[model samples]
Target: MGERGVQVGGRAVLPGALRPWLGGIAGLGAVVLFGLGVLFAGDSRPGVVDLRVWAVVNGAAPPWLYVAQAMDFLGEPVGAPLLVGATVVGCLLLRRPRAAVLVVLGVGVTVGVAKVLKSLVGRTIHGDNLSFPSGHTAFFTSFALVVALLVAGWLRVGRTVGVPLVLASTLLAAAVMGWAQVVLGAHYPTDVVGGWCTAVAVVPVVAWGVDRVADGRR
Candidate 1:
């Protein structure tokens, strides 16, 4: 519907609004496609095997493995968690409690849903059933979304320019993180796509709903 901006770090930023809906739909599409790939093709198929082989091959390179290791660290506590935790605290300090709450809930739901889907789907890699969805990818995607929304709301920059810039940059970073997971043999391609979809599907809806409730209260 309508768009609004909040102040963060002394700049105006836009909260979750239309972008969330658009992103949610796009993400849902990815999830659906990949879920079908997983269900119909099964893990032993050529598509899955080929991608995994490529990742393993490229990953053997010193440079690629180094990059994967670095990206892997980001998904850890000192990386995504630290970044998200700090961002949440920043939103609270800036008096945007709803944004902070959205960050927490969005990430929580993304992780929780990923876990459930992985369990139900029962895809395995390296003897781990959790391979159906890459938790690292989801975490990084949610982290990017939080930062993007926070920056949009904090900067007075027009949504037309700011939203696209933030989204593009964040999505690129998220993609890199997903690639790293694949390179490290941590997940299948479908798993990484599934993770990205989870964040897209969950974050926007939850953020929008939180904003709506906050508006109702006001």
Candidate 2:
């Protein structure tokens, strides 16, 4: 598709020219593998890697703790909706309705899946709080993915540039959220990994589906 030809149904949808579906597939595989590992490890206990990472991240200096709390707030009830709403409004202003829909579905579905998986995995931290996949991490990562995809589409960049842009954005968001979750004692390091992977597994497919539906209607 040409740069301007990427539109569907007279709206600027996801750029179908860039190939993110392959990354989506790999993400799904990672989620499954991580889930199986969680199951095998049983409940409420940190793995070897989790222990090491947690040891490093769980305790923080006072100043750094404040920074972590600020980052954590972005995933909290008050902050999350604000972020999502802002992104949706921004997409609408840019005339990218499909991208706006994607931001909604991407964040909602990713966080929803994390919640469901917490029940299925039955992993707990700090007593009865389920924490297999950190919902906060998933929320931020999903939002980041949607934003990156929208930016890539807007820039009309191809896989060579788009892929790196998306990956870098995703990794940065995930790392920040993951650190906050760990530092706050909300989840283990592996739980943060699961949440990050969930967003990676979900957002591209959601984008593709949005594009497919828009194209079908057209």
Candidate 3:
């Protein structure tokens, strides 16, 4: 199975033999664990983890405060959705409908799951609404993940460069977005972590769906 995986245009695309069932199950398991952990920890008031992280994030310098505010805008209700829509349209125009659908579902699933879990846990901070998982973090991270996967598949920069450089840059962007949410006092560390975990949990499932659809057509 491992030997069957092939490189296309310098990018490694896993073989269809791996199957969607396995990836879907694995991804679902991770999502369950993340949801359970967040709900359990947030059942009561803010715990030590929340407080400590909150302190660190809130202790940022004035310049960092400005940066955080700027980064915050990137995921505002309008900006993130607009970017996602544009990406989806671009993929569709490129004749990759599967990729476009994956991008759309990727953001939708991540954000939807975050909202559901936040409501179920009923966690709030400083008398505000649910904030268990940072939606901003999830939005940007999921976008980055889907975009990276599609772009990497489309543009082959060799395994040596593509796998290391492209993947690293995508992750760095996600991390920076998460950090911005934390530094801006928009979310606790756990919230940011949960958001990231949500995106990680979602992207694979979406990819698996795309693969299954493609395989069925073939």
TM-score of each: 0.77, 0.89, 0.74
**Cα displacement (Å) at residue 114, model 2:** 0.8
Model 1 Cα lDDT, one tens digit per residue, 106-162: 787877877777776666777644566678888888777766766766564455766
Worst 10 residues of 2 by lDDT: 1-10
Give the clashing pairs for model 2: none
Candidates' C-alpha lDDT: 0.67, 0.79, 0.66
Model 3, span 1-218: residue lDDT tens: 23222332222232233334335534764776466565655554656777886776665687887888777887888777788889888987987776777888878888898788787766676675677777888788778767766666676444554445434644676678878877766676777767776776776666655555545423
Ranking by lDDT: 2, 1, 3
Worst 10 residues of 1 by lDDT: 5-14
Q: Write the per-residue lDDT of candidate 2 for residues 48-80, one digit (tens) a residue.
A: 988899777657888989999999999999999
- On TM-score, the candidate that comes out on top is 2
Model 2, stretches more than 4 Å misplaced?
1-5, 20-42
TM-score of 2: 0.89
TM-score ranking from best candidate downward: 2, 1, 3
